[model samples]
Target: MSETLEQRAAPAPDGPEQVRAAPIGAPVEGSADEQLPTPTRRANPFRRALAGATEVLGPWARVVWAAAQPVVAVVSGLGWVVLGIGFLATLAGFILGWSELVFLGFVPLAAILVSIAFLFGRSTFRISIHLNPSRVTVGERAIGQVLITNPGSRATTPTRLEVPVGFGLAEFALPAIPKDGEHEELFAVPTNRRAVIPAGPAVSVRGDQLGLLRREVRWTEPVELFVHPETTRLHPTAAGLIRDLEGLVTKTITNNDISFHALRGYVAGDDRRYIHWKSSAKTGQLMVRQFEETRRSQLTMVMTSDSRYYGDADEFELAVSLTASIATQVIIDQVPISVVTDRLALRTHTVTSFLDDTCRLQLAEGTFDTPRTFARETTKRLPAPSVVIIVAGSQLEAQEYRGIQRLFGPDVNVFGIRVERGARASIKDVAGMNVMTVGALSDLSKVMSRAL
Candidate 1:
């Protein structure tokens, strides 16, 4: 006989099918239409009571935490561990009736209490951080001064001040200062590499000798020290890369432009303003003027910051210096320029701002790994350029250079600068693009002059 849908779906009562046990308080897995057996186990009473108490004491716990924040900030990590041990030992000693553990615990507890007294006083002083010549080239000496003046009427107490200089910290011991007296601390920052290093927001630290607790008070705001790449000075004219008043002329013909090329028969959609009346009268046909297209001398530079394209840090640094040197000369000439990397675009409004942005450039793995992809993505965001320069390390293959050149039209002048340390500097033509290999920074001017 055929069975009904309900009978087929339901489990047999006398079959070998075993019911799996679900976790306590978890819903049993079964069809909603069918009534399932309830779970026999109940939740533990202790856990249920603890949860209820936690819900009732939530507000009180928050209040306690808020009050303890100051103490928590001042207490060091070691202080917390010692405090915990002290309390646990004291409690265990009372329960076990052992005097030795109680005495051992009292030592740390007493020391922590005594350490709190060291952080009692306040610091009131005017502080200022001054970096002499806040911008410097790599391997140059960058000096900074911290001036602290006691503005209060009474004498100031002795304290220790910590000034964070890049990755290192500088500490100074300030003696007692009379009213209206000033103290000066000088420090030198290491500028071995190109980077944007933060100098200070000088902080005064008060702590005991036991290393239990510390209180820090910030006095001054932090300032950035720009360690720019060492760049060479290119020629003022950039080897005919920039035309003074008139823009770069291209072979593309346009109906209206500054440079006239030839005359042609008027098309259907020709502009009426460009019609050559004299030529039309002689030829007995509607003739229009055609002119060669001219684009404003806009230079767009793209540098690859991908680590995979660089052999070492020196090669990347050389590439940066080469890019900066060329871009700086262009900026000095007041030409329209845009400098970009695989990661971000740099500001090119002024020479100082341009070099300052280069100080923060770093090599990393990015979305556009190859020159072709980097150029393809970058060209969309910029305007049509008369000159395009691609800067990269020596690790960039020859095929990649050809791929980059194909992205732009024949009208756009494409140049590639490949930086390779300790290699001979030379310029070669790669698929109609001028590819220059630069070994050292001093060779940039000679190579650029030859290439351009």
Candidate 2:
């Protein structure tokens, strides 16, 4: 800039030449207002948000770390202290005399080397997590993925990676993280009701260069694994009769056409029994009846919400699993099934067909508030005759079952199923309904067989 520009820019002792200036304490004429700029925060779109959590250690990692920290500390201390002493001796020799400089230098050098080793070891440590199924049904198994990854740079031997399952934790040592990636990891995912599997927290453990510092990074990608409910097959074994509620099978009963849905145009290879002659004669169009097997009686599937009877932890999980399993069987068997719950509306439609996954999740959670209310409203809307099947946890009392049964006609056949904790169960009487008790999901088929 030239002197002329500098002089032009300087404020003069005298006011602007002949310009009308605004009076003091008065608004200035035509003065533009400007706002100050503020810094904006950038959000991470890739990394998941840290929800209600403290510290990076995952639930599984915490358990393992708690147990292994003392051992690791002891080993790490012994190894590094010797190196530190060696380093101090080498430094002293370097300052005093040149004798044994190489040998003395080995001390401090060893200390630095040890620290670096620890740091690197901490960086290279691997953590493994196992999730049963990548895909699982809702309210069933939410086990997402088993993860094993490095959190350190240097090699880490005897590194512990323990992950929690249910309430207990399992520990394992991950192989050193090579330049490549985490080693072979396997997990067996359980069956799920929904279509997506839940994702668990990721584990990253890094050892310091000298194997001194250890950093564990926990990453949770909140994911839900979805798995469709398995199609139910109710095979009945009786004194003289054998029957699977599903599939095409005729049963001797008062109502042969009770399960028939609607008539369709007869085509090639049509069953002669399905032909509706009167309707064909009336419209001069060939029509046939689509007959589905009728269930024994009107059904209501009560999925319980009360956690007390369901208990805490996996017990509640088992109860929910039973509910979905029964729901699946009922729909597949062409049973006129209405799901009843304690609070809020989950799913209440008759399951003569497959209900979508959203409805299944709702049913498991027992979000549907009142069975009596839903039954009353459903009765007014749908006039179809149906039986009642109480697919619920053992926690619900017989009175609730009886109250639900009374909503339909007096002849409505109601069957209650009691869910057990594990793989063993015995039947118990609930009101007038025949209650079939079962342990584990494998026992559900047995209960359905009795229902048939």
Cα deviation at 146, candidate 2, in Å, is 6.7
What range of 10 consecutive residues in model 2 has the weakest lDDT sum?
A: 1-10
- Please give the lDDT score for candidate 2: 0.46
Which residue ranges in model 2 land beyond 4 Å of their true spot?
A: 1-182, 185-200, 207-214, 217-233, 236-300, 307-325, 333-385, 392-397, 409-413, 418-452
Clashing pairs in 1: none
Cand. 2 TM to true fold:
0.38
Q: What does candidate 2's lDDT look like per residue over 13-115, in tens digits?
A: 3421112212223332221011101211112221122211313757876676667554443334344555556777777777887668648668555555555
Give lDDT for model 1.
0.76
Which candidate number maximizes TM-score?
A: 1
What's the TM-score of each model vs. the native? 0.81, 0.38
lDDT tens digits, residue span 88-205, model 1: 9888888899999999888889989999999989777999988877999876766677888999989989998776655445567788878998987776655667877675678898
Per-residue lDDT value at 232 in model 1:
88
CA lDDT of 437 in candidate 1? 92
What C-alpha root-mean-square deviation, in Å, does candidate 1 show against the real structure? 20.9
lDDT for 297 in candidate 1 is: 92
User: Candidate 1, residue 412: CA error in Å?
Assistant: 0.5
